[model samples]
Target: MKKSLIALAVIAVSGTAFAQSSVTIYGKADIGVARSIGSDVNELKQAAGSRVGFRGTEDLGGGLKANFTYEHRFLPDTGAVANTSSFFTGRSIVGLEGGFGRIDMGRDYSAAFWTALAGDVFGYDGVAANGGVAGAGYQTVRFDNVISYKSPTMGGLTLEASSALKEAGAKNGSAIRVSYASGPIAASIATEKGLAGQKYNGFGASYNLGVASVRALISKGESATGVESDGMLLGLVVPMGALQLKASYATLEVAGKDTVQQMGLGARYALSKRTDVYTSYANNSKSTAAKKNGIEFGVQHNF
Candidate 1:
C-alpha cells in the first residue's frame, strides 16, 4: 500500500512539472508553376519558401520563461534542402522572455529585413515578390552567431537590436530597428552596418484605410568601394472577403549605372483558414537591358 501511494505521488508531481512546458510543431508548404525572368521554360517553384519548425516554451515562475525554436526550409517540389550549407536555414534560436522583454542567441533575421517585410504587400512571396527591392543593398536575410534583444511593447512602440559575431574572419555586423504599430498605422526605420564595410538604412510605413492598405519603403546601401544605390517601393493591398488583391512598383538606381524598375500585380483567395491559392505577374525593366516578365500560380497551406 505504501509503494502504491508513493507511485501515485510521483506521478502527480511529474504531471505538474510537465504542465509548465509546451511544445508546438508548425510549418508552411507552398508550391507553384512559374516562368522566371530571362528563362523561357516554365517549372515548379516555391511561391513562398516552404519550411517546418519546432518551438517550445517553459514557464520558470515569476513571469519568466525559456524559449527555443528550430526551423528548416526545403523545396516542396523536389523535397530538397533549401540551403546547402545549413540545415536550419529558416531560424535556429534559443531565448528567454519575461518582464524585461526577450533576448535570443543563434541564427535569426536581421532588423532591416523585418522592416522590409513590413512594406511588402505580397508578404515576400510569389512572382510579384518585392525581394529584389526590399532587400536591395542589405546583408543576407539571416545572420549566424547572432545575439538579439527585443524590448517590451510600450504604447505601440518597440525597439529591437542585434549583433553578429565575427566568426571565421567575417566582419562583425550590428543592426537596430524602432517600430510602431497601433490601429491602422504601422511604421519602422532600421539601419545596419559593419558587414564587410557595407552599410544600409531603410524606412517603411503602412496605413490601413478600411478599403485598402497602402505601403511604402525606401532604402539606401553603400559599399566599401564607395558605390551607392537607392531603392524605393510603393504597394497596396485590398481585401474583399476571402479574396485579396495586391499591386506594387519599385525602382533601384545606382550611381554611375543604369536604373532598374519593376511592376507587379497579384491576387490571393483563401480556400480555408489554413490554405490559399494565388496568382501573380511581374515585369522587370532596366535602362540598359531588355525587359522581362514572369507569372506564377500557386497554392499554400499552413499546419
Candidate 2:
C-alpha cells in the first residue's frame, strides 16, 4: 500500500510539471505554376517558401518563460531542402521572455528584414514580391551565431537589436530596428551593417483607411567600395470579404547606372481559414536591359 501511494504521488507531480510546458507543431505548404518572360513553358514553384516548424514554451514562476523554435524550409514540389547550407534555414532559436522582454540566441531573421516586411503587402512572397526593393542590395536576411533582444511594447512602440559574431572568415554584422504599431498605422526604421563595411538603412510605413491599406518603403545601401544604391516601393491592398487585391510599384537606382522599375498586381482568395489561392503578375523594365515579366498562380495551406 505504501508503494502504491508513493507511485501515485510521483505521477501527480509529473503531471503538474507537464502542464506547465506546451509544444506546438506548425507548417505551411505552398505550390504554384509560373511562366517567366523568357520561358515558353510553365514551371512548378513554391509561391511562398514552404516550411515546417516546432515551438515550445515552459512557464516558469513569476511570469517568466523559456522558449525555443526550430523551423525548416523545403521545396514542396520536389521535396528537397530549400537552403543547402543549413537544415533549419527558416529559424532556429532558443530564448527567454518575461517582464523584461525577450532575448534569443542562434540563427534568426535580421532586424532590418523584419521591420521592412511590414511595408510589403505580399509579405515578400509570390512573384509580385517587393523584397528586392525592401532589401535593396543587402543580402543578409538571416544571420547565424547571433544574439538578439526585443523590448516590451510600450505605447505602441518597441525596440529590437541584434549582433552576429564573425565566424569562418565571415565579417561581423549588427542591426537595430525601432517600430511603432497601433490601430491603423504602423511604421518602422531599421539599419544593418554587414560584410566589409557594407551598410543598409530602411524606412517603412503603412496606413489603413477602411477601404484600403497603403504601404511605402525606402531603402539605401552603400557598398564596401562606397558605391551607393537606392530603392523605393509603394503598395496598396484592398479587401472585399474573402478576396483581397494587391498592387505595387518599385524602383531601384544605382550610381552611374540606369534605373530599374517594376510593377506588380495580384489577388488572393481565401477558400478557408487555413487555405488560400492566389495569382500575380509582375513586370520589370530598365533603360539598359531588356524588359522581363512573369505570372504565377498558386495555392497555400497552413497547418
Which stretches of model 1 miss by more than 4 angstroms? 1-9, 256-258, 287-291
Worst 10 residues of 1 by lDDT: 285-294
Instruction: For candidate 2, write residues 1-303 as lDDT tens digits.
Output: 999999999999999999999999999999999875445578899888899999999999799999999999999989999999999999899999999999999999888888668767888887778786777767368889999999999999999998998899889889999999999999999999975778889999999999999999999888888888898889999999999999999888788564658788999999999999999998877634343787999999999
Q: Report lDDT per candidate.
A: 0.87, 0.88
Model 2 lDDT, residue 226, Cα: 85
- Model 2 TM-score on a 0 to 1 scale: 0.94
Clashes of each: 0, 0
Best by TM-score: 1
In model 1, how many backbone clashes occur? 0
* Local lDDT at 245 for model 2: 98
Error of 1 at 53 (Å): 0.7
